[model samples]
Target chain A: MIPVIEVKDVVTHYGSRKILNHVNVDIQPGEIMVVMGGSGSGKSTLLRHLIGLERVSAGSIRLLDQDIGHMSHHELTRFYRKLGVAFQGGALFSSMTVGENIMLPLREHTNLDEKTMAIMVRMKLEVVNLAGFEHLMPSELSGGMLKRAAFARAVIMDPALLFCDEPSAGLDPVVSSSLDELILQLRDALNMTIVVVTHELDSAFRIADRITVLDKGEVLTIGSVDQVRASTHTRIQDLLNRRFEETILDPDEYLARLTGESI
Target chain B: MEHSVHVQPNGHIVSFSGEIDLENSPAARTRLLEVVEYATTVFVDLTAVTYMDSSGIASLVEAYQRAKKTNVAFVLISTSPAVLRVLQMARLDKVFTIHETLEHAQHAKH
Candidate 1:
């Protein structure tokens, strides 16, 4: 099968600093790809590039076999309509009820009337296991409920590609595992390609068919869950074992920085 | 419709068996409504229920509403995992009165 997403020689720089260096990944159709790394590992930057929010300095990103760089503005909009994104913080409009929040995308993109829209919203809520909770405000829900609500909104359109950022963050173990189960269900039920960005090791292993480990602005390894877990690489080992690696200081660079400081 | 109702000293104990789903929820709703109409209080025993889908949940909601409107006390007794999951997902575990055991629900104040 043709890969749903292909990234080749992706180079991204933030002002004078290089953030992503020749990153490459090929995500298969209906696959769950978990991009994981510690802080400042450029995983988030790669996500931004995938979503077309950040411009890559050099590379080609072919989503659904269409090169993102070659697409027109209208083409880009149409391309994005087939994709869904769930942000880390839920990003719900506190003003709207849960039903309205899930219905926002449909209202913006479709011309369905109120009744049809309501039925669709209910169906999506049921998929997320939040049925009969549409009228409640965001503040009325617990943290886990908020995340599920956000997921309901993201899948409202039934996008072929879904990107979830830190889905397990701030959730307890049971709730997190349930959310992971929901992600797998979405993939099976909708034939969706899901890319999850999470630092939670258990959650990643539970959902990911393949995982891409990013470290210091490069792709460390892209492999199956077993391969990534069993690798003997020091950085990957440190990350998997949750061991803190002592930062080795460069004596010459340290002396130069210390001497150059204004005193 | 595969259920039995016993008029206890405090309230009526209604026991439901088999699968309480889309097909039987209508009959369940009809029987449940009848019990809640005359009784001062009703206790739903779902321990023997093999399954309950969303429609079953709706039927219980209807019973709750009927009890609320007619001033009849409504309570759920002895929940099974299959039934409890749907209830909790709908957040009705907080909405409805629940008891750990059928005896507690049966003898407790309505």
Candidate 2:
């Protein structure tokens, strides 16, 4: 079967600094692929690239068999209807009610009747465990509630591919665990190919069909949870054990920075 | 998706095949509601339905509500596993009147 998402030798840079170095990953249909890394490891950048947010400096990112890099503006807009992205900060519009936030995608993409759109919003809220919170404003909800509402909006249209950035971040263990279960249930029910970018090990292990470990803008390993847990790679072990790596700076570069002079 | 409506002695049976998704769910909703307006009983056959998204399920929900309000019977007959999983996800399997076959739906009273 054709993979739903294919990231091939993708390279990205912010100004002169390289953020993603020849990254490659393939996500199959109905599979949850977790992309996990430390801060500045390019996991978030990769998520942005996959969702067509950031332009890759080299190689290509294909979503649902279409090369996003080559697509025109109009084409990309149409293509986005098939994908969903739940941002890290629960990017609900404060002005709109939760129900309206969820319905926004349908309103923009399709000509389905108003009643159908309303029911779809309710059903999505029900799926996300925010059934009766639809009438409430974003400010009225707790952090976890906001995240669930974000998820409801992301999935209101039943997207074929769902990308979640830090889904379980900043929530307590209980709420985070519930969000993990919700991701699993979404994949099972909707047959969605999901790419979840998270630094939370427990959440990654709980929902990932396969884990893609990244370090320094490169893929360290991509394997099942057991394989990842058993690997003896230093960086991977450090990540799994929550050990921070000490940054070693070159003597000349350090002197150059301290003296404000070129080496 | 392709659909056919058969008027039986008891009710109108609407059989849908292929995918019921955002593109065509509006049509399904319109057809189901129109049939429910006149028929005493409506049976939605999903045995051949390959896929159904939230919109399609919403169509079913709307029709079911209309049926309830009109005092007409709304029954789902022979649901595919794909469709059933989605229904079960929302815990809607318990909400709709479902049966394994037309014979069972005919014999059972809603």
Candidate 3:
């Protein structure tokens, strides 16, 4: 299988706190790889690093034959134009219409005329089941529509890589399920590679071609859905069962944090 | 939700009270676009607005686009944390000139 993204010995940190320790991943072309972890598991940080948003202290990240980790700011900016990101918060420009927001990438990266831009924007929206609503603002959309709009904007440029951060977060179960279906359809219809960072177990199970489970900045396992489900790793089982281990805290550190002396 | 649009000497002041949301945003967008066509300046006063969602944000964005197209100065006056947080998430704080009060927004020469 051809790899679209490769993370090799990727080490990252937040100040002195190690976020990702020697983590590696290979996402195949046209595959939907879901990265799942509990809060503070560094899934989000990894997404940031993968997308060239955050600089990593160590390791090499190659996306589509180019080393994103070592790319210059100028080069990164140009490279980023070929990518699409849908943040958890929808990240749509509140000042632009849905049509305008969806067309933003096309306008920025391509010299398509106004008519062509409008046509492409409408087409993408239609794919997301948001047709005839382009005049509506992001605010007018329901949570489901908002997510769909984000997806539309993300795919407007026909990017080779699409990164979605918590696409189903804060949405209702039915809406979220529909979003999962849309994600699958998007993969099939557009033939784009997607990297989704999420904690929603149901969403992960529904859309992922493969699941990459992370725990405390480390990869617990990366395998097919059935393999992940049948894995005997205590951490993986705990994550799947929603069970949290008792964190034995040291008295000194506990007292320090309680009294604000830790800082 | 109650929305009103007025033309001040310095610019246009569009005010909203109660919820600026899905039910009211269409009307609000209509009102703002009306003023944005001829007014060289626009200031949306959202001080009394208790709640705002995506629809409300879209209204403001439409007004901003109108302002830009017609070369009108557009600013948003918001002191409510709820409203401000949403703007921050959408990163519209960088796009719209935001102030704490209508007075500051009106006097903002920049």
Candidate 4:
């Protein structure tokens, strides 16, 4: 079977600093592939590349068999209809009610009747266990409710591929676990190929079919949860055990930075 | 998606094939509602339906509600596994009257 998403030897850079180094990942259909890494590990950058937020400096990223790097703006906009993204911060518009926020994508993309769209919103909200809260504003919801609302909005159109960035972040353990269960349920029911970028180990272990670990802009390892835990790599072990690695800087480079000089 | 209606002695049998998704679910909804509005009983055959999204399922839900109010018997005949999985996920399988064969659906009363 063909992979729903293929990232081949992708390289990305911000100015002169390299952020992603020859990254390659294959996400199969109907599987939850979790990308996890520490701060500045390029996991977020990879998510951005996969979702077409930013272009890779070299190589290609293919989503649903289409090379996103080569698509025109008009083509990309149309292509986005098949993909759903839930940002880390629950990116709901404060001006709109939860129902309207969830319906925004349908309103922008399809010509389905108003009643059908409304039902779709209600169905998604029901799936997220946020039924009857559609009329509430984003500001009126609690943190967990906001995230669930974001999930409902993300999945309103029943996208083929869903991306959730830090889905379980900024919530208590119970709420976080509930979100993990929601992700699994959505995948089982909707048959969506999901890529979730998170740093939360428990959440990752709960929902991931496979885990991809990133360090210093490169993929350190990709395997099942057991395989990852058993690996001997120091960085992987450090990340897993929550160990802080002390960095020792080169004297010349440190001096250059201290004096504001380009080395 | 392609839909055809067959007039039987019992009721109108509406068969839909291909993918019923966002683009064509409206047409499906309109046709189903029109049939249920007048017919005393309606049998929806989804044996050949390969794929159906939420919009298509919503169409079915709306038609079922209309049939309930109008005292029309609405039965789903031979739902494809793909459609059945989605319905089961939303727990709508318990809500709709479904049968494995037309003979069984025809014999059962609402």
Candidate 5:
């Protein structure tokens, strides 16, 4: 199938350091495509390349059959309207009430009158389960509520492509799972193509239709969670099994046996 | 009144026998903390507990820490199998001693 977004042999660099090398992937519509990696593994860098936040150093990134790499500034501005980004921190304005934050995008992008905009704001808040708290300032909300409000703002325009950076971070597991369900609900409700950049293993396994794992600027594997878990690739095995160095450490008495040292 | 603290001369028993959820966890926590103040051995009876979530677990962990600070030995008893399973899943059983009945728990040495 022709993908909604396709990157072909894309090589992106920061100054002289190459970050994304020969990266190629395809994202389909109405699926949650997760980009996962360890820290400094270029997950965010790849997102930047995909969203046109950074220009490609080589190759092409095609979005909706248009070449995003080669677009002019004016064209890129028009193209971005179809995409939505909920930053890792929710990135809400501290000065604005929840209603204003959700209303900003609609106000800037549409010519709707005050009455219509107000209704739309309420609708978006309801989508995120924050309907009645629209008048509350950002500081008055809990961590989970803030993330949901930011999510409400992201979808205010009913974007075709929704991008979330670590949507589950800082939330407890139960709350995180609920947030995952909300993301899935939004995807089905709007029929939107979703791309999530996260390193959370449990969340990734729960919500992803397909996952693309990156390590040291290279593609590791791209498949369903079961396929990735069953893969025998050394890197994949180490990651899936969580074979961190700390977990392998023997008790101090056992360690002393190997070192021939007294405890 | 809220949940009661049975203050015997030997130990303090704070028994909870209902749903403990996020909205009411604060009250539960306060009740348990108050019980720890009266006795060196504090027993929490949860055999009647039907359901508990992460917030309830967190409140218990907090109470455990507070009891430790006061040199009180905190123990949990009579957790329903369902609630016991959740505590075991979260690996809190290793940190807490689980008992089949409040009497068995109160009699066991801390």
Candidate 6:
């Protein structure tokens, strides 16, 4: 099958600093591609390049077999309509109610009437477990609720491609796991290409079909979670092993060690 | 929608018995809300609550949410395994303070 998104040797730079260098990834339709990295590792820059929000300095970016660099204005609009993006912080409109916020994209994109839009809104809310909170203002919501509302808005159009940035950020573990489950369901049910940018290891492993690990503005390693976990590349080993160590250790034992206790 | 409230020196105890279903939910919700208003802590006994549906669950959740908002310690007591299964399925088991018996729930408060 043709890849939904293909990036070959993509090099993105901001001024003199290279944000992404020689990065390559193939995102298949209906699979989730997680970009994993530490802070300032240029994962966001790569996403920006993929969505055509920022141009790559060198190399090729192809979506649906068309080079994004050569797309015309009309073609670009059509291209954007096929994809949905949920930015960090949700980025919802402060002036609009949650229902109105989700309805904006549908209203602008389709000719559905008020009743149809209301039904669509309720359906989307049900998907995200926010069915009755549609009438509530954004200010009335908590952090997790805001994220789910934004997610509801993102999928309102049922785009072919969906991108999420740090979906678990600022969320508790329970809520974060639920959101991961929702993302998995979205991918399975919608059959859309999902690209997630995040540093959370648990969330990444829980949702990713494949992961591209970046370090110092370059592709460190790209593989399934098992391969990445078993990898011996210095950086990958160091990162994965460090987290593994914490999970394996008993907290009380570790604390005792910190207190200089034997055994 | 029968409510039996036992008043003590410190607080009032409200015991919810029988089945909570769509038929009696609204009235039950109203009475439970009112009963929780005067108590420092409210223990809702669900052992005798033989049946519940989504509407019953919604009403119970609303009661719990309201009690939380009002700063009353809400205790869900004697949750039958059947009721616990429903709560667990809905992911509400983690949200509420549930116990196997009324005394166990009361002991937890101390």
The segments of candidate 4 whose C-alpha lies over 4 angstroms from its true place after superposition are A243-263
Best by TM-score: 2
Worst 10 residues of 2 chain A by lDDT: A243-252
Error of 2 at A114 (Å): 0.4
Task: Give the alpha carbon lDDT tens digit for every residue of B4-110 in model 5.
Answer: 67877668878877777544655786677677776798888787777654345656777787889988999888647656654654356788877888778867888
Per-residue lDDT tens digits of candidate 5, residues A70-114? 899999987887788888888899999999998888577555445
User: lDDT, candidate 1, residue A183?
Assistant: 94
Q: Write the per-residue lDDT of candidate 4 for residues A155-261, one digit (tens) a residue.
A: 88889999999998877668899999999998988899999999988899999999999999999999999999899999999898772221232666646644658
Q: Candidate 2 overall Cα lDDT vs. reference?
A: 0.91
**Complex DockQ, candidate 4:** 0.53
Docking class of 5: incorrect
Colliding residue pairs in candidate 4: none
Top model by DockQ, which number?
2
* Number of backbone collisions per candidate: 0, 0, 4, 0, 1, 0
Between prediction 3 and prediction 4, the one with superior TM-score is 4
Candidate 1 collision pairs: none
DockQ category of candidate 2:
medium
Query: Candidates' interface RMSDs, in order?
Result: 8.5, 0.6, 12.2, 1.1, 17.1, 11.3
| DockQ of candidate 5, scored on C-alphas against the true complex (2 decimals) | 0.01
Query: What residue runs in model 3 are displaced by over 4 Å at the alpha carbon?
Result: A243-263, B1-110
TM-score of 3: 0.65
Alpha-carbon RMSD, candidate 2: 8.0
- Model 1, residue A115: distance off in Å is 2.0
Can you write out model 2's per-residue Cα lDDT over B30-83, one digit (the tens) per residue? 999999999999999998999999999999999999999999999998658889
TM-score of each: 0.65, 0.94, 0.65, 0.93, 0.65, 0.65
